[model samples]
Target: MDPLYTTTDDPNDSMENISSNFTDSYNNQFVQPVWQVVVWAIAYCSIVIVSVVGNIVVIWIILAHKRMRTVTNYFLVNLAFAEASMAAFNTVINFVYSVHNEWYFGLGYCRFHNFFPIAAVFASIYSMTAIALDRYMAIIHPLQQRLSSAETKLVIGVIWVLALLLAFPQYFYSTTAELPGRIVCYIDWPEYKIWDFKLTYQICVTVLIYILPLVIMGVAYLVVGLSLWASEIPGDCTDRYREQLTAKRKVVKMMIVVVCTFALCWLPYHVYFLLHMFHPDLLEERFIQQVYLAIMWLAMSSTMYNPMIYCLLNDRFRAGFKQAFYWCPFVPEGSYKSLELKTTRYLQTQISMYRVSRMDTTVSTVLPFGTPDDTTEPAREEEPGCLRHTAVDLSPNGSTRDTHSKTTPPPSPTTTWTSED
Candidate 1:
């Protein structure tokens, strides 16, 4: 959410005396030097550029490729869309308003400026929360049914609906006021004789958007981490099992880093606002403008880091990024194409073959002699009615030699694959 500034409703308050009451100030008295303004402009502009471009690429990577359209990636696409929309629509406007201490745009944008960031932030954090829950279900309870594609879309829609509901108050109360010398946009919260509504709303927003979701994700990841990392693998575990475990661990680790980055970036912003709510005198300080700008820049910078996290920590996302940027002179077209084209098929075939070989070994090991008993148990534990046999050419000459082999179904019914795999 954008930082809230104190504004007054009085038309008689002159520009010079505006800073008398920090809660009733319209025209800002503190002004930075030319060089400082230039530096800040560059800093803020960099965020907008990197955030918009990076998140759009992430969205495209997930949406354009059929192979990348998994449940996790769907939530990621929602996350990327929220970040990109916030960066494109709010980042520059936020910078300009905070730096200039005036509203150049009229009333409609003022409402949007105040409204959209809250919804976007709500969407961003909830999307991450959805991912945490999804991962927990996938890793901690492997045999459970996962969300289908349609259900995933429904969840995303529900997230946005809640986001809009949470942010509607900001949109409703936002208005532009003509001060002594300039115009300023701020929320004209209605007064209540019983309680301070603005402060109450601020506290609620911080709890809902920042504290609560982080706590839930923190606990979910904690259990998932223990399940994934603290367990001892069996001595007879196959390489296939090890690969799946490692893939799950990598995904959990990547998400942990993303969550940590977000928490750190917004921690200062939240603290600053809380302090201001309790003590309005802080806004009257001469250096408060610079402090606000710095804190806000850090908070807004969170929108740009997720794409980099995905590219660095996940192999499939890395390959998707390579394919997206294959036109660059430094990126080799051949290798990029191979990474995109061959990796999926190669992994699938290797897994299939390994499953077949493992089943063959199990059957041979269980029944050495040609005698079959009804009491004899299967070598491995599998879901009921899940085993299926098919004919494969196991001959070295690639001739039509009928060798029966067992293969699991497509997309793996038990475990969900992350974008990394």
Candidate 2:
């Protein structure tokens, strides 16, 4: 069989002729038009800048403020880490490979180039899954045990471990192979079972990375939405209780948008990958190349939007982000005051409810301090943020008290701080 891309015809050709021909071929294959290179450079740089900066800000905000360290935020932190790592390591490499069609980074990095992104992607998707589950448990079974910090750590550890295991195939099969005159970094399967191996791996990744998480997130959120929209508040429910519920629901809504966005961004990329796998001829078409680039861009851009979603939808995260960007004149100290007041009111209301029910010795008959229909004093504008709740204990004397409660702490020093898992 003729060599796929070789330029030489005779073994008797001089070494100088072979070298010259190879250089010409390599340049022809690898060099992009100047205009195309500029366009791709801009696109890749923008994505890398947004993803790395946005996710780093998220991670920093979460770390700086203890108030931001909720179970859900922890997962977000994990996601930010994955996104930042992926953007840092893969963005330029992908751009060069797509534009140049050569592997300049050599064999060692070839394995890592493929493996790290896969691992990071797996970690990111599963982190989102973990958040969905946490939210489901919080909303669907509020009274049941919440995941403690230690348990959350365990789950995160498991996610990374699984991601590493799943990405081992890239490490095993990715290498730099000479094609014609250029070295290309690609996954090469054994000849005997190449198609079978590829098909199995592709199916597994599609199912595990995209399909499974999306399905579980959809189901979990569906249940959570039903429970929130359909369930009735207690007869004596206070504004604080309603506010807390509203806050929780806002979180659910934000997460729903996040999951939807993730699915939309990744769908085309996965489709393209599967198509290329099944129809290798399509890879040679310029239109298909453009489509693939667009899809990959969308997928890469997914990492840039979560922090924005959190900032726009969740008051607490918004506040955290504001704090993170405090140098900007837009985020003032007063922005957080309203959220603090609301949080303080919530804590006080829970305590008041416990005390009033205790005095009356009747949990069912106790009336709320204020009418639910009546609005209290006007306060700063607010939306769904964060909350802290203590367990309630009922005594034999027909009194209710908090199992482990204390005076509400002072407000955080600033607002608009956000964090990640």
Candidate 3:
């Protein structure tokens, strides 16, 4: 019999064949018909290309554009980085292993091969959780201050550290064992209670990576959605208020799509691993290899869809993506200007004055309020002891008073939101 076409009827021979001729036997048996390999190769390559380009564009938008640098966007940047890394490092390696049925990259990459995907996934899911919490804070308590850039940086730093710690177990346990002429990458648990250890580890990973984050994000988005939908806009109906409301709703929608897509894409992969852990016999099934490949590709495909979702659902992100890939003819010229997020202006004005008591005794005055450039109308007298302040106008050159104040004036505040980019 030809070595390539040899068949083992005995279970012992089959086991020996798997150990010794894993690459040759499995390739000859499974990847029959060259067209199947070509199709799968094309599909996996597309996933990698789309994932890398889309995630890199997101990172570029957040980093290059000053206005896009918000706390939520910062968390998104972290997520994009994780996805890009996973696609670049894990996807092709997985495809090769699936087709070849052996580890050929030697031992060093085998450790990383086991380690990186888990860590990247941990970081990605936690980043979503952080974004959910950020949105909850922003919407639920509008008066409360949002996380500053520095604070967000610190949080992202902690997330990566935690991800590394969580994935360290894989690196510790994984090894490439020589099986006849080939090497197979697998976890080498100790002789005692290896099943128990694997079960516990997998359970812990599933909970932290999937269940906990899912719960937090679900509750957060639900509350945020209800709050935004139920709450009423204050004051008269102005274009600015309309824009703000529209932007807020769009952001909520984008985030909901992101979280839901992530959950759906990863659900099958996690469930399969959990089932495999409990039933080792399933691994011997003829179709088990196909099932594993399908679930894994589904999981990795998750990274590619978020960028598409963002581009489709969000005007700001879409515009940013277009700007990054301006050469793409689909992007219309001069549209990004209007799509840029509205800049928020901040100014501080200090006042020093004396107030009169009932007996006309002087008292220190401490009145503070923020007014935008457009709302600096004459103050309507409401009651006694009421003081009205003038709104400062921000301009191209410098901040100038509107000259509409009737009372004693305070020190002029310099505006930082310049007209030019």
Per-model RMSD to reference: 9.6, 9.2, 9.3
User: Per-residue CA lDDT of candidate 2, range 74-146, in tens?
Assistant: 7889999998888888876877776666678988988898788878989999998998887776556654566
Q: Rank all candidate structures by their lDDT, best first, as comma-separated numbers.
A: 1, 3, 2
TM-score of 2: 0.75
Task: Return the top candidate by TM-score.
Answer: 1
TM-score of 1: 0.79
lDDT of 3 by residue, 157-232 (tens): 9999998898888788766556655566666544444356656777899999999999999999999888767767
> Comparing 1 and 2 by lDDT, which wins?
1
Every candidate's lDDT: 0.71, 0.65, 0.67
Name the candidate, 1 or 2, with the larger TM-score value.
1
For each candidate in turn, the TM-score is 0.79, 0.75, 0.77
lDDT of 2 at 70: 56
Candidate 1 per-residue C-alpha lDDT over 247-286 given as tens digits, one digit per residue, 9 for 90 to 100: 6678789889999999999999999988987787687677
Give residue 184's error in model 2 in angstroms.
1.2
- Tell me how far the alpha carbon of residue 66 in candidate 1 is from the true structure, in angstroms, after superposition: 0.3
